[model samples]
Target: MKTIATASMGVTVALSLVGTAPAFAVGGSFHCDRPPIMEVMEQVDGSSALQSIVNQYLVRWEARNATEQCQAYADGRPYDISCMNGRRDWPAILASVPKDYFGRSNESLAAAVRDEKRKGNGLREAMAYCRSVGAIK
Candidate 1:
């Protein structure tokens, strides 16, 4: 009787797993032939050193924002969508910093970037600078 009951439970569990399998397959895909963001940044003339600085800035931004972004996404707020989409522009912000600023410690640079972002100057001003400097097209 115990052996028969065990076999019955195994069959029930297998059926349940099969029924729910499609739920695990949910996610969209993005297809892009262009190089990744960092690679594109590095390919810009005079941007190799700037790319390193941008990487440092991105590491700090991700550390600071990842949790909040994840929570926002979990809550189904559109805010996370905008936030995730905007991340591709961050490298331009780091590149916008005056070259002199690169001499500062990473902490200082990160702080300055955060401050500028808080003041609403980071993305707009940075992208403008990048365009002017030819760091981005």
Candidate 2:
């Protein structure tokens, strides 16, 4: 009878811990140090057209980061949940950009960035494309 009682207590404690673990999970109120892309762009030139494109790129970048973090959390990999939550603001920033600039989807933009990096121009080509879009400008 004593063994049974001890086993029951252990089970209860385990269940309690499982129930409350998420409440104590590491998440909420995190900030990113990533600087505004405009600050970086300003060093080159102050074209408002370029600024808008860079802003959209930043938004997509944040969204990508958030997606990776969320996937990490789901996979039981260590991740900063608070930072991921903060990155969730990407949707709002993305909405501010012209639809044409975004391509078919975020993946397309990611691919484009990757291609730009591969060419060794870094993101200059992408930014120039953004700035050169006469229709939007």
Candidate 3:
């Protein structure tokens, strides 16, 4: 592991790396700092590294949502779609998906969720993925 502190971001990022390149992981939030994530978004889709960044970001968002965004829903109130975790994160997701899986194919966000469910994996798989990154207990 190497410690990197950028002057612009002013945050120290401790990442396990090959040489000095940060190894992206699934289900990580990196303290919600957006630069590293945005940087990865510029990478061409279909790269395994890209997928890891996307997955980890989602899990990180879920962690924040549950601990910090989904309070109303957690209170057992009626489901309010407005506060759903990852509700407005489509760009991040879309930016990281395979080019063919999205832009060229015109995949909508709802359709992607539906496809995940149709494949017999959705929240259940999400929870598992989140756990893989220690985002949740």
Candidate 4:
């Protein structure tokens, strides 16, 4: 990683790079932080289990009402967003999805919610996915 001094929005800032390009900018008029959504997407892409959770949600969303869709997503996983181990919460779930699945989809958040409504899978599947992705064990 490398750091560079730059100016933005009338403020001087420091930018940090990963590999060869800048990844984040700090102490600037405009700051870039990794939103939970993007971060979770990265995590999800890296983990089979987390991706399964997202897929499960998508499947359920196709078959149920909004509330039922949300419920089906949880599948009685104990916590609202966590798997058995409690590491993956709603934010983590959001971050775990693959970026390509959402890029330029324009309404991925809503789409993902809708996907969760199409449920056939259950809590066991979700837990298994979580475990597979190493989000839980």
**Considering every candidate listed, which one attains the maximal lDDT?**
2
Using Cα atoms with residue i matched to residue i, what is each candidate's TM-score against the true structure? 0.32, 0.34, 0.27, 0.20
Question: Pick by TM-score: which candidate is best?
Answer: 2
Tens digits of per-residue lDDT for model 2, 34-128: 33442323321323333335444453454345445545655667655343333344555455445554334334455544443343422233223
The lDDT values for all models are 0.37, 0.38, 0.36, 0.32
Q: Write the per-residue lDDT of candidate 1 for residues 1-137, one digit (tens) a residue.
A: 11223443343334222211111101211112331333324333332333344434443343334334334434555323122333455555466556665556545555554554344413334333333433333
Tens digits of per-residue lDDT, candidate 3, 19-104, equal: 12222223232233243333433332433333333444444444344443223334544332222322435566455444544332
Overall local distance difference test of candidate 4: 0.32
Give candidate 2 misplaced runs (Cα > 4 Å).
1-26, 29-44, 82-137
lDDT of 4 by residue, 77-133 (tens): 332321112223445445544555543332445455345435343434533444443
Candidate 4 lDDT at 92 equals: 41
Model 2 residue 30 CA deviation (Å) reads: 6.1
**In candidate 2, where is summed lDDT lowest over 10 consecutive residues?**
15-24
> How accurate locally is residue 68 in candidate 2, as Cα lDDT from 0 to 100?
52
